[model samples]
Target: MAEEFRLRSVAAVAYGPATLFGLAEGAILPVIALSAIDRGATTAIAALVGALIGIGSLVTNIPAGVLATRVGERRSMLLAAAVTVAGLVICLVQAGSGPWALVLYGAGVLLIGMASSVYSLARQTYLTEMVPPHMRARALSTLGGTMRVGLFAGPFAGAGAMHLWGLPGAYCVGLVAIAAAAVLVYRAPELELTAEHRAAAASITTRDMIKRRWRTYVTLGSGVLLLSAIRQARQTVIPLWAAHLGLSPTTSSIIYGVAGAIDALTFYPAGKVMDRYGRRWVAVPSTIVLGASFVLMPLTGGAVSLALAGMVMGFGNGIGSGIVMTLGADVSPAIGRPTHIGIWNELADIGTGIGPVILSAVTALAGLGPGIIVSGVVGFGAAATLWTYIPRSGALRQARAECHD
Candidate 1:
């Protein structure tokens, strides 16, 4: 079994396409706001335009599951790839259009986000079905690790391209990346559908799935939401705090890069620990460390201290790569895996979208330190949620197996 678990096919089949898609997404992220600014939009409107990507994904999550259910995983991915290509094309042209072209660019960004929701959910479902339970965490964690690698590399790729051509060159890079990913997904063999999957044919509504597994959703799902929130909040908190401390933009980027390095290094080890020891071993420590680090960030007086705190936060996050998806897979019924994952991702994204909002709102009212503290408290809540619930479902299977052995 250990020999079987190395799974070179899984590595290539799963991680390869994820890397391309992640790279495309990472490359295009900065382009959205930049494009809007280029079109002469106000800063506030530019920010809103940039956010359309998340909003598009948020709205499409449930529909993505339905689409995956109807079309099957491989086909769904190809379709998403097609949509991404179309979006990138629009973005490529929008850069040269008039100022109202910002709306066109926003529309393009929205389409890309919709495609991402479908692509992400389909791949997660496919992996959940294919990987055995014992090796599930490693497979998914590496999927996440590959994504980190892709996203980390994407900006550099885009910057190089943009320097040669212009803003439109970034979209060209994304187009190439997504096109390659689509080809991989197309050539891959189709997933073998179960009897239940064939029977699902649009009858399995999100409403039906919720009624059945609402308990799991409320408990473990709560943890997923909080974990996502605090994690997303870190994106805003780290940079803003650095700026608050009077750090220069270059210093801030360097600090961020260092923390990201720490994060990218931890995923595989974390997966191994989750697989061999238990999810609790990683879940509790990751959340506590994440929460405590947020609490500690405000105390940092300068560059060295801030970078250290960021590294601590990064380690907490890195270890818990795919924790949400792993837990979702552990409990999702085979009969409606796509729908269940859709709902699970919906919760996760909702948390992701709200995190920055909460942080900004808190910053407006009580100042920055208190907002950081609030996220720290949210981390504690995530730790508590995972602590109480893991044994009830995912971990219990392993515990029983260990006793039997």
Candidate 2:
């Protein structure tokens, strides 16, 4: 079963589109706030703009999943890419148009966020339905790794574009990348659902499905939410901390890029460990390490030390690649996979959206160091929750046992 589910041509086709989408997303993410800043928004407002992506994702998550079920994964992805392109065009047209530019750019970012939610849901549903259970972790982990590779490469690409054509040019790169992804997805082989799978999916309403799985979704899903919050906080806090430390933008970018490289390198091994050992093996350590990195951030007095902390955090993040997705897949009912994933991702996006807001508010009330320390505490709390709840084996075992009974 594992051999049959390995990275075959079909998987590669899905991955190709994902890779391009990731690259596009990665190129824009690190710079959205900076772009807003350049357009004359205050730091707080700029951060809000960055957070809008998550907000948009939150709003669209369930709808995106429903759309995927109705239209099929391929068509949903294509529609998402098209919407993303429209957003990019708006950003490009309004570049450097002063305050109005901020509004337009924010709108563009929101649209892209909507598109991303759809794209991600489509791909995740595809993998969950197509890949066998035994190989699911590795396949999803590889998907995570591919996205990291794009993210690792994106900042550098944005930097170049910024140097040459300023911030809006980075959006141009994203536009082009997503366009290519759409083309690839269009050309990929169609995913056909088995008759039984279709019947199962058709029998359940999204609301009914959520009601049935509320226990696992709320209990285990809370852990996923906190983990996502910590991850978002890391992304938010790092650059702000670097600025506080008086590091050059160039230096900060390099440090983040290096950390991303470490993250990308570890995805496959982490997947292997999850598949061979258990999800807990990777989950516990990753959460703890990430928390430790946040706790240690204030201790770093210089760029070198900060980089080290980033590297440690990145390593932690790397080891848990696709973990949230894997767990969602594990517990999701086959009949309502898309709807379950939608709810799972919505909870996670809420965390992502709120993390930066919390950081910003905390930093304003106390200080940057203290704000980050608070985030660290949250991470520790999440780790504790996972340790208590995430099963020794994958959640699939429990899910299967319940189905059998």
Candidate 3:
């Protein structure tokens, strides 16, 4: 329990930058979309802003993983912090005209995503080492919940900073958060690699490692695909629908903020479920809620309706996402934990990046309601599989096997 508590502290410190930047990053998206439009970009180009960031993450994930393994988790985190800090500095300093700003934005987002991958992988590796397997889901759930709290709090700060100081302020906010995160991480005690862990790490090459961990890799990718599709509807299309229905951006921000809060609050109980019942038990309901939220979106008629939709959607996202995150870390081999977890979340980055583009097309062709409905239905289908594959009994068996091995 003490070890779990320590792991939790590390996770909280590690996740702080993400929380701060998530707020700034999300706020900047709408601004970027609007700016691209203002700069005479077509809808296609505007959406490219996000796409470029995803591409950057895809390009960087593997290397980031490898690098973390080579450097050790603490050093990797420091490097990640430096890279993110640099990107934020660039955005803050280079807020100029033309495609150059786009380039800088893409660069910053890419670095952030890359750093995110490394930080996440290292954090997972560190946690796995500290916390016992049975407590893992609960610990990870706590981490997931913390992340949601960041998500919940970040946007409001971003919006406020943007309102008070414009894009530069938002960027500054992210920069400060990144810097603060660095300070927190640096202050925390570092985890060192022992000789056995090092030998285990060294015995496997990247290609060999992937082959061995493909089960986890495949699961991560499939989960990402499902979540990405759902997130597209929720983050991009749902908000657009809200705007079209005459809600102010502030109101929309509030809706998102509230949902994030709900997500944060739910993490503990969800983690408890995963701890007691197993990962799949908690994950199944989460994915279903995520899907159901989209299905329920069209029913929202006013601010009250929108808020309700947001709350439901947020709950689903919060619950479902926690399971996936915890399990991804759970199934990964100890030797290649960083590399494996990095690859797992890179899929998430890819899904997030491509989400807006795909959903935009759906919204253009079929109207937001139909598009969102499809997303929800897809989520339901994805959620249905968890029961079969990840039952509590199965997970228990697997956990026992892992322990024995």
Find the candidate with the highest TM-score and give its number.
1
Clashes of each: 0, 0, 0
Model 2 Cα lDDT, one tens digit per residue, 242-270: 99999999898788877878888999888
User: lDDT values of the candidates?
Assistant: 0.85, 0.82, 0.67
What's the CA RMSD for each of the models?
A: 2.7, 2.7, 3.1
Task: Give lDDT: candidate 2, residue 18.
Answer: 77
Query: What digit string (tens of lDDT, one per residue) describes model 3 on residues 1-405?
Result: 675566556565555644654554554544556555544557887777655555666777777778767777777777877887776676565555567666666666666656666666666666666666766777676666665566556656777887888767666776777677777777766666677876677666678867887775565456656666666557765567688789998788778767767766776777677777777677677778888777888878888887888888878777665565666666666676677767776666666765565566676899877777777776776676555555455346546756775
RMSD of 2: 2.7
* Cα error, candidate 2, residue 310 (Å): 1.4
Per-candidate TM equals 0.95, 0.90, 0.86
Rank by TM-score, descending?
1, 2, 3
Candidate 1 yields a Cα-based lDDT of 0.85
- The reply for model 1, stretches above 4 Å from the true place, is 1-6, 95-99, 392-405
